[model samples]
Target: MSALGVVGGVLQPLLVAAGAPLLVGVMRQVRARLEGRAGPGVGQPWRDLRKLLRKEAITPRGTSEVFRLAPLVLVATTLVVAVVVPFVTTDSALDPVADLFAVVALLALGTVAVALAGLDTGTAFGGMGASREMTIIALVEPTLLVAIFALSVRVGSTNLASIVASTLHDPARVISPVSLLAAVALIVVIVAETGRLPVDNPATHLELTMVHEAMVLEYAGPDLALVELASAMRLTVFLGLLANLFLPWGIATTATALAVLGGVLAFALKVTLLGAVLAVGEVFLAKLRLFRVPELLAGSFLLALLAVAASFFLA
Candidate 1:
């Protein structure tokens, strides 16, 4: 790999690891401020992670090794994605793993790990949450695949780096119907996959409505910290993908230190803006009923399908 590629490979994961929590904190603070409350600073999530790490790790009774390993698996997969995705530079550290299919599978693996862990716990809420998560994933993964495929069809490659490079080369595609429809489709999957508002509220404690939270109820201390951190990182990965896929102007094309630095700054700025917008929008929206979520997801799927069709016909 080139110097810039190596630098990006190292820097991307570090930024995602360190910045994910701050992103969550920023979103929470934005929502709080919009609602006229004095919110905790952006460092609050980091503080919480630190505190959780210092606490005693707990394993619930009768739970198997799945419970113990899920957190690590979740984090491990996300970290790999942070490395492979073209967040900082187009040069992938592992080109073989930088395909759109591989990235989506890695993400799905993390989700499945947590769901299986929840099922292992043998609790009513755990099973409910696991089932609900699987339901969402069923709709989510296909839409994510089809939407990205829409972009790839025009580029003639499924490799994410190639797609990003193509977008950078043909800036006009950004305003095309295929791109716009894919963008809308991607935005919905991002919100759903990340457990954001109008799909699954990340902050809610009520069991009736819990999706992500319900699955992790048995976790405590450091394990819980890992889960939360992985969750944040997943959001960061998705948002970063969305930003770079659609508005890839500021991403570094040349292999230079200054260019890489610019890419980092651009990435952070884009993701923060997206997170803030999502948070502000959430303030004015309520979580959709569980039964209503499929309708929303199906609508997104249709958009993705349309995008794919448009890409082929318009091209």
Candidate 2:
């Protein structure tokens, strides 16, 4: 890591922590407005976090250490990702420490922590949610890896920052069919991974229907706050990665102060716009039945596979 990279790594978490709540709140507010209701404003997520923090955490009787540890692990893993991935600038200090494969592994670790915690509680609902989440992850992970493989194959590196820098240096890469197909597969993964519409509805409380909510239904107070914050950060990190990877034009390549500032502004705008697009997309799309989700993801997987084939065959 260059000296500037160290500074960037330090600042990345603070930026992510500050912006995640606002992004989540914006998506919620926008979606609500689309649904014809006066939704909670963009400040709502921050308020919700504050309200949860002030309350006491109450763990249930049948839980163990895993239950208590999972929330912290979840937040910690996501914080590492926020620090390593090129959020605002392509000059990533932690680049070698966690490449694209490492990023996926860290996220998987967080998922495992939560899933184990869910199972540890032994609640029927928790088990059901964990089972469903694991199933989805199993199906989606290959597509995620395949999509990355396609991008990396095009750029000749698995490092995300390198890929972005390479793609920016070669404008023709943006128009490649491999890039488009990979992006389509990735967008679908983002929808599924973030528990958004047409997959698992984040806002729903239907006992038999909600996948993400059911796992954390037993959490309250500070623990719940941590889980919620980590979830928001996860979505933010994903969107930031998507923005930076596909639209690398405005990202800062150097550590100059003014350049960094521009990169930050550009990244924020890109991610916020992505969030708005997803929120609006959700307004028109209905959530699919649980069984149907696999079919949708199966299509995504095929697209990703084709993306990989195109990169190797067409190139």
Candidate 3:
């Protein structure tokens, strides 16, 4: 790879890691405005990160080392996953190994680690959250894989870069009903996976209703910051995948400077529009009861399976 390529690879994660929190801030701002409340500044997340970093970490008396380490693992896994995803460009250094299945596996690994750590804390809330989280994952992952398989069938490859390349090579594929179904299924998966509205509420602290938040209730200081950052990055990564894989309009297939810049702008625009849609969705919907989450995910799974069948018959 050229020096610019190497540099671009290194910068991708940094940009995503930083941009993730900013995206959260923006979403919050939008939500606040819709709710007629003045939101915290867009830089609020950065301030929170800095404050968390400076505070001393406190572990519960009975907590194991795994609890202490989970935050670091969460951040590291998110960073690694972000690098593997085709964000600004398809020429990721890690693209060769970026199989869609492997990406799903990595995400599952991170989820399991966090859930285990949550249960390790011996808190009722943490354990409850972990249970809910695993249940959601069980319902969501299959649908995610099925959606990806739908795309894989069209592109004839499971590698994400290849999928993007195939779609770019034939833009008309996006308008197919199979593509539309897959996109819809993936969007639902994204909402469920990212702890957004109608599935889980990211803004709530209620123990009974909070799945992701309950799991991290025991985390404090730098550990909490890392987990929070990881959550944001995870959201960004999934949305980025949805944008680039389906759209792929301006994503760079080669390591050219102008192409990279165009890819960056296109990426920002896509994610911003997605974030706005998410905000509006949250505004219009209430969080589902824990029991109802499974039904929602099941519908997504069926849509994804239908998408696959459609691709087979139509493509």
Candidate 4:
């Protein structure tokens, strides 16, 4: 691996893992400010995780190792994506394996692991949450794949680094019909995948409406902390991908220290801005009914399809 790749591989995951909680805190604080409420401070998530780590570990009766391992798998998959994706630099450590399909499959594996963990619990809420999560994932994975695939079509490569590097070279493509449609499609799927507003509310714990929370209702202590941290990292990863793929202006093309530092700063600013925008928008939107979520995802898939068509016809 190149020196840039090695540096970025180490820096990117560390940044994502540490900053993920801060990102969540920022979103929550933004939403709270908009709604005229006193919000938990931006450090609150980090505080919560620290507290959870100190608590006693608990495993529910009758649960299998799936319940024990899902959190680790979820975190492991997200960290792998962080290391491989072109967030801090245009190059990545595992560049050869950074194919779009591989990254997407890694993400899907994490989702499946969590769902299986829910099923292993054998509780009514866990089963219901798993079923609902599966339903959402069925729609989400396709839109995500096709949407990113739309971008890959133009570059003639499925490797994510190549696509980002291509966009970095030709910035105008960001305004093309293909990019716009794919951006919208990606944003929708990111929302769904991260359990955000208008799909699944991160703050809601009402058994009747919660999707992600219900699945982890049986978890406590360190396992719960891992799940929560993994969820936050997934959000950061999705936002980082969305930002860098379409707006790769400040990413480092060189291996120099100054360039890499600038890239990291730019990445943080862009993702924070996007997170704030999402939070503000959520204040104005309500959760869609469970059955209607597929409709929204379907709409995103249609946009991605049109984008793919446009990429070919307009090329």
Residue pair clashes in candidate 2: none
So what's the TM-score on candidate 1?
A: 0.99
Residue 129 accuracy (lDDT) in model 1: 97
**Model 3 ranges with Cα > 4 A deviation:** 1-8
Model 1 residue runs over 4 Å out of place are none
lDDT of 2 by residue, 235-276 (tens): 999898888778887777778888788878887899899999
Q: Which residue pairs in candidate 3 have backbone atoms (N, alpha carbon, C) closer than 3 angstroms, thus clashing?
A: none
Task: Supply candidate 2's per-residue lDDT for 242.
Answer: 84
Q: Could you give candidate 3's per-residue lDDT for residues 1-315 as a string of tens digits? A: 444445457767887887888988888888899999999978899899999999999999898888988888888877877777777777656766578888888888888889999899998998999999999999888999999889899778898878887888989988988889989999999998889999989888987789999889888898899998999888988888899888989886666778878877888788878887899779989888888889888999999999999989987
Ranking by TM-score: 4, 1, 2, 3
C-alpha local distance difference test of each model: 0.95, 0.88, 0.85, 0.95
lDDT for predicted candidate 4 compared with the true structure? 0.95
lDDT of prediction 1: 0.95
Clashing pairs in 1: none
Query: How far off is residue 156 in model 2, in Å?
Result: 1.6
Q: If both were scored by lDDT, which would come out higher, candidate 2 or candidate 4?
A: 4
Worst 10 residues of 4 by lDDT: 200-209
